[model samples]
Target: MSVDVFTFGLNHTSAPLSVRERVAVPGELLRPALDALRSTWGAAVREAAILSTCNRTEIYCAAEPQVVDQLPAWMAQFHKLESTSLQPHVYRYQQNDAVRHAFRVASGLDSMVLGEPQILGQMKDAVRAANEAGALGTLLHQLFQRTFSVAKEVRSQTAIGANSVSMAAAAVRLAERVFGDLDQANVLFIGAGEMIELCATHFAAAHPRGMMVANRTVERADLLASRFSATTMKLSQLPERLADFDVVVSCTASSLPILGLGMVERASRLRRHRPMVMVDLAVPRDIETEVGRLDDVYLYTVDDLGRMVQTGTDARRAAVVQAEAIIETRVQNFMHWMQKREIVPAIMEMHEASEKVQQAELERARRMLARGVAPEQVLEQLAYGLTQKFMHGPLSALNRSEAGEREQLLELMPQLLPRTERRR
Candidate 1:
């Protein structure tokens, strides 16, 4: 049986942060999660690759119908959730659907912020992790290679990424709405994750008065801070220094809010109600929602940023159309390659049949020559034998037919046989 490429999982689109965070695989646990998936779904999946980012967790697999069909149950078991809880939030794609999904994801169309280029690097990292865990195979490897190529081609050929707003840019835009001029503000970035790094880059362009990176690991914070000529602080010191910076943008993998209402309230009192603009980009938001109610604190969650990011999507709808057109063309190109792959079995079968016929004829001819049959006679017998096998069906059909069918065969044979000999 032939196995088709399959993909299933939830993302920012299908599941809320509540459900998504429960199953979210951290980078450090990716190998273990992949190992668990392999052990649990071994029979169903021939090969597997997983990509789990802040916005999505998707599994790509090569498997049969049974394996593909049972994937949801396996996922539920693996994540230790009720099947119903996971099933509604999951979307499954098989064969070309899976291929197209992979391409679109790599191309950044499926991103929370459309056309963000960071996803490509994230996907590369996921693939590398899966490979390191010994979970990737030829199908997944090829799919990802083609996906990268499609992404590169789309980036080079279309204006999909051009003028697209990034989360970092959106974070800065929201902060500017709170604080008029960033040059007059001290900005604090919490965590040194990729999102924070990107946010720092955009904010640094504004030439903020001061920039500080506070991370759980001081080394990572220092590494990020040096790029912007900023200072680094430990996460524990955030409460003390929180009042010093006017703008705070935080996105971290913390299980709970890093900036609670109490902490912000204390900071607001210390700053003498100077009005702090804070954006919490994390899922389990870094800043508590109640902080928004504080007199001197302005807090925006990921949901708030989502609304801002969606506004400009309308303006870019035309460009999105153009991008979809480009994507469709590339999808068809990838599907064509997949289709050729599907027919390989039939092609191999035809080659094997032809080889069998040739070998049988050769063996008979060799025996004839060994028995002292004339060279020309041996060649004639071989040709007749090969021709008979090749034309057996049409000859048998013509002989069995009585009237009109025989006449049809007689007319079709000359046209069906090649006029020139097929080149060896």
Candidate 2:
């Protein structure tokens, strides 16, 4: 099978949430989507895996090289989106470039929040799901295995992750920008998911005046709230309690907007135009876009937080130089292994040819012994015959050749012989 690594997707860089959400593959639908991709494209996609988080959705495949060209079309058809809609936003990488991209992504270099460790786990989960679906093969398997090792190395050797501001941390930063310090801010979190939990953790570290977790399930909200010594409520209660908080951070999986413009306007009126900082980390966006226009409301999306988090990226430029050196060396080693593997079929063919020569000469010697030749003489003749047969073609060619031809053959003879014989 012709094997290649290819990656294609859009992320926080190439597209906004409006574009991203249209192509975001829900975890429940991932397997079916993969199946559809494989079936739609057939043999071109021999093995495939997808990593679809809120920040990015990427397809990694080990297949025929031509599939790289077909991916955009496949994605458009599968998502029921226009080709133009995806073409402007997608990035594609092939072969070593794809491998490097996968490694960087797993290592968090490609993250919206650089060097964040959560993406590595999310990638692992994607690989595991692909494995369960029988879509992972030697190429993708080795790619991900090395990707994890590279990530581990980057974390252990570099300070890339140090002093990094996570999305949750950035949400807190944006809140601080509005409220000066979070100490007096009453922080309200929407959703009891991992994102909300992480935001709650970071906001709690700021020692907010009050913290509350709101979710569809009050029990789950209460469960997460207890960890931070915060209170809990149902999502239904948010409209009434909205004005009570000075900061709201939301990341939920709801298909529709959870916090609408009217709701925030009402909350602003309730608070008498007191400024409220709102951060929407959700894909579809829990908060309405028009809410950002409200005079008393400061609304930020994940992209806004992403821009804010990029502030100290220049500081990490030194560490990036060092990390790139390590990754380059590893890439060369992996490419070398791949190069060696490519020659295996030719090596096996040469070995089979040599075995045939050996077997044919042995049979000839056995026939001489069977003809009643003396055992010692038979052995001597066998050795002589084997030597002559091996060298006959080259020696004959050398004898009939001109001066330079004979010189080259004589030079090669020693190398053609066994080591001990050549030394003697």
Error of 1 at 201 (Å): 1.4
Work out the TM-score per prediction: 0.85, 0.84
lDDT of 2 by residue, 1-424 (tens): 6777789998988988888877877677789988988887788788999998888989999788877877888888888877766888899998778888888888888888778888999899899989888888877888889989998998899987888888998888778877887888898999988788889989988999999888898889889999999998888888899999999999887777999999999999999999999999888678889999999999999888888888887777677777777787777777777778779988999688778878887888789889988889878877887787777777788889999988888898888767764555
Q: lDDT: which candidate is best? A: 2
Could you give me the TM-score of model 2 versus the true structure?
0.84
| Ten-residue stretch with the least lDDT total in model 1 | 310-319
Q: lDDT of each model, Cα atoms only?
A: 0.83, 0.86
Residue-level lDDT tens digits of model 1 in 304-418: 6666776676555566666666667776877788788889988999789889999999999999999999999999999999999988867788889989888888998998775
